[model samples]
Target: MNKNPVDAALILVFLYPLLKGFLFKFSSKNMKSDIEEIGGYISFIIGVILGTYLTKKIFMIHQDGVYAKIYNNIPEQIISALESKPLLIYVLVMPIIIFLIYKVVQIIIDLINSITLYPLLDSIEDLLKGKSGFVKRIIGLLFQLPKGVCYVILLALVLNVLVIIGVNDTYNKKLNESKLYGNICKNIINPITNSKLAKKIPNVINDSFKIVIKNSEDQPGNESGKTIVYYNGITLSEGIKSNEEIDSFSRELVKNKKTSKEKAKIIYNWIGQNIEYDYDKVDKILDNDFTIKSGAINTFNTKKGICFDYSCLYSAMCKANNIKVRIVTGEGFNGSNWVSHAWNEVYISEENKWINVDTTFYKGGNYFDSSIFKLDHKDRKIAG
Candidate 1:
């Protein structure tokens, strides 16, 4: 439950790949400095940078949802721990201590290599005189372990360079929205972009476009859409006009439900089983030709919509039941494509925490993680 993404990423960069040699019997950089110096310093620097990023991400990542409970109390936790162990500050700097230990070990490794490597390799070629088999080739490749290690060290840096682009919000936004990143699912041929590749190599990159993986697009969501439905003489969009209907819907679901969770589950099941997704409407919504008033009012009236309709309609029902509810906006992945989504967050006093409820996903078989509407859902904003 560390839940520190940066710390996890740092370990992947500095320790995970290197430790692969020990864990899976596999696994590596510098010229001005030797391999040991380069590796030890690189690992320490990366660790420090990631540790810094973790401090920032923890506060910012969980600002708007049930997940906020994980990080919002972090300050209190630190205070309590410090109260128990007055010298907790020293423990927090353990990474620095570990770095120093790495440096000492590196110095020893450098010394051992300097003293023993040359003498060991001097007449080693003569030992392999008649060896022409694959084993000899393998052994010969093993002799270049120093170079392999250096290459891996450099590879780690290259990988982190890609990662740094993602961790920074400004860079990430630019990348995700860029035409360079959005090279549509359709393949396109262009003169300037394709000419250079065609000349350099024949079809080396047949699919010559930058690959970018991003969460679903940003949306303010149906909070505004709900208001749009109020223009006329309050039709289906008028939950107030439709109060009797809402009461009827709730009577069947919330009856004899003494607890908030039970009421929420009954509502969830009702919607999941009754309402359906309208695939034909997707293209219209994207084209902006569709009506925007398609909110809670339109949803219950129609009983079918995209994610927006599902969330707004669900919130409207919860409101009728006298339950506290909020519409949440974010993105989700259903194992393949990532798309913008809207869902509900209901406060159940029994749990004393907001439970994520993704009615849209309830159709996908099972969608019951209150902690996260979907393991793939990432909370981005509150009401909108």
Candidate 2:
């Protein structure tokens, strides 16, 4: 991701209006001819810019270190093979490629509807009247040309000049420096800021903390297994306050017994059943705690978060149950510009492999059930 606020702000300034315009014109009944709908093409162009901005933001947030690692790891043979592949194969082989083409086609369609069809139709409506003064007719014909062309041209030139000035100015040099400094802060400060209670525990227990401290008791050679157990125990403790609470919840759900999957299912159902999607509420809650500890409760109570919140919470809950989990964030179906989405890869011990879990759609109470969690791991390249 570029991490340039000017670039992002410029993109948003252009896209928000364009996308909104496209949607409005496309659905409006007042648009009788295509030429008058030139406004719609303007909107589509904005959408493209907005989509680009979104893609960059997502990549920055989710795939922090993955890109550098991938670049370093890329083999000469692999690069050669990739480079040698025919361009035509992109249509058949890469889903992301195909999706990009579709988005381009959509833009083209909007352009045609706005510039060509709408203008011609509006002109036809004017021409249908047989009588007019010669000067009046000439002025009307000039008016038929697309509106705001001169203004747009001037705006573009001014923007280009400003960009050049900003790039050259010593004052702007500080902006890049500040940006780099911010990135460093994010890399170092973020982990400490976000670390949970479990992550703070020492290898050797001093009996200061009240929890079981499983890993510390287990001696040397068996340390790794004990660490996993310890982390898993911390996760459970954080998830539910007490074993009594867990037992009571389990008994309420069934007559006698409950497996890990059953317990997970219960949590999943509860989240979906309780939480409503409320963005403002979620943002307000998260503004207080940036840690992963703000999981299902954040989602359930606030009822809003982007896909990241949804998947992270799901993974956290699975982890709480001693289930090993990995969170995957990537572009979804259709080359949708890889906007941020998150889902979990759960390790089912009985199956001995990771399986995908999407809690967002699940939480939506099946409103988005169709094709919701349909992402394939093979389709996703790991982002940090």
Candidate 3:
């Protein structure tokens, strides 16, 4: 009849084992086994609580330090993997550590039990064998309650961590509605989370997400690629245009150009000098009020577009001139912060190399084949 039925249900769940243990009359052998089972549960509870705490502390304190130490030594491919999911490596590694801790604790408890605890439990069971059911129930209840409390505390700690790591709104709402769970969180879990170690947890998660966005290359199926493509995590439409117009314009742009590198440079400089960044489109895109009005052709005709437009237009021109090129979508630094941007990586047959080109940043400086080009332009994926 409690107002909080969910809380009542949880209480019943925890007490069910106690109730069952007391209600059923076990043989002497079964009682000894049950007593042994309690020891195993205690060892398990200790392992889970202590193992989780230790694992969290190690990562919270040393994760960034570990990342820094290994960053320079590893290959760029592996560095990209780390940047994509900074916490994932820790998640994978923690289970092994926790398992080792659990095994160690189990071994110690087994040793102690063999030495004295098991014999004492056996003597106690013998005394209880002739006792009334009511007395047995009381003792069983006493044994079960402590274990139940530990289970509740462990559940509370897990819930708090889930909240900090940004659990789903619906789950959060349901959890908040549970008065019993809320109290457990506030009184029991909040103190531990209020510590300096706990405060760093959210920061670590946020920083990891930031690193993923900053360093991630645009890949065909990457979620980070989608995030870095447009404002407010919008996906940029591919700036598709017919070869006819691009071919005609490219031929004029690279008139009498001797080599592929020459043609690529001409197209890069032309897009940079002529096409203006469409600030209006950026504002409308952020508000989700913009429509894709012919990606490449619109930009070519209007002489304006965003980073995606610049890259697309450049790519079209390069293809017209038979240069191997791709539209790379990823985050770009605009002096202060990284944002969704696009650029080009053109393959120069003469140099036998691929170089970055950012026509969107044309006015900023010479981004074409610049050595420091990768410093800002994170190549996420090839759009074309």
Candidate 4:
């Protein structure tokens, strides 16, 4: 009844002779001697196999079960390293497998000898005694050393495998994010930072239209009736209510602002701090609706968008702050090449001029200069 399989197997080997004696005594006198002899050999062989296989399985289960607990409690950083090196896993685990197999085979052979009453061992009780026994002991010692090494290796391997899957997912995410940051720096700010004499070009127009423009930064102009809208049972007078989030954001920024200059700076800084340029959306401008209705809301919520989204959202915020801003689209340099782009023009009360504010450029860092704003921001069609 010993639950330990190794001990039970050893006991069964010794007790087999007594059990066989009782069985042979109760057998019929007419039974063939060959039939009894064949049965004994067959039973011994079967017992050796079953005991070896079950003991191996039980030992493996117990070993892995303990390792599973250790694997769970290990630090995530170590887990990540282990997963990246699969060879380390093999080195750590293979030894344990070898040792377990060796022990299982050894125990099974002992069981076979006890059950079969093999003549080789029973004929000389001390065949494995004296110097012969000493040699056997030396062999056992050599195997035990390797067995220990194998167990250590396999334990390490199991723990490493347990932690790798999660590590791989986290690594992929960071790698993708790094690529995005690198792309943004390469695309948005690299052009203006490297540009020279772009300011001296006479074609960089300050004003195109013949009409006189006025500084409406604090004008509170009602030229557009859509400035005031009611939401949640409250009347709000904000020009840039392009979407609920933008509207809410505008209100929070300029709630107690006294002047248009302060409000404009707040909106400019907010857009510069929040939105990221959508490099992918630049190619799909014709297909995607990059207007205030959908674009501004999406940009504000997602924190990423093309120049169109940046301009649209900025225009909306300007309107809510009672400062008229335009989403201007035209051809501009984006790094080493000129491409179609969108930016903003906000009317300043102090300067009495329309100043370009590219939130996408500003988000790159504090690297963008206001003096050279018109160098790359070409004026095209304007949208309120």
Candidate 4 has a TM-score of: 0.36
For residues 1-384, what per-residue lDDT tens digits would candidate 4 score against the true structure? 324432333344444544443343312221223233434443433333343333323322213565556556658775565445433332444334444555665566557654664443233334434545445544334323323333322332232223222234343233223333223324322222222222221111111111223433444754533343221111212323477667777989888877776788788788877776554444334343333223566677788765556666788788766787776666553432234455677888766877667776663322122433443445365644
**TM-scores for all candidates?**
0.40, 0.34, 0.43, 0.36
Model 2, span 217-273: residue lDDT tens: 456656455543222123432432324443344346543324555555665565455
Write model 1 residue lDDT over 188-277, tens digit each, in one string. Answer: 221111222212211111111111222323325534323332211122234223357766777667988988888888888888887777
* Cα shift from native, residue 125, model 1 (Å): 40
Off by over 4 Å in 3: 1-6, 25-41, 63-80, 87-90, 154-167, 187-196, 199-384
Q: What would the per-residue lDDT of candidate 3 be over residues 1-384, giving only the tens digit for each residue?
A: 555554765586577766766676434455556556656666665665565555444432223565345435557775466446545434564556667776787788778867875677678788887789888777766666655665566666566556544446555455556778766754555434333333221110001111123324556656653444332232334464536877897898898889998989998888878888776666665555545453677788899777767777887788777789887766664432234566789999988998888887776545788644654555377655
Overall lDDT per candidate, in order of appearance? 0.49, 0.40, 0.61, 0.46
Top model by TM-score, which number? 3
Clashing pairs in 3: 217-380, 218-380, 218-381
Instruction: Give the local distance difference test score of model 1.
Output: 0.49
Model 4 pairs whose backbones collide: 92-153, 92-154, 93-153, 93-154, 95-150, 96-150, 239-320, 240-320, 278-305
Q: Which stretches of candidate 4 lie over 4 Å from their true place?
A: 1-241, 283-294, 364-369
Better of 1 and 2 by TM-score: 1
Q: Model 3: what TM-score?
A: 0.43
Report the C-alpha displacement of residue 260, candidate 2, in angstroms.
5.6
Model 2 has an lDDT value of 0.40
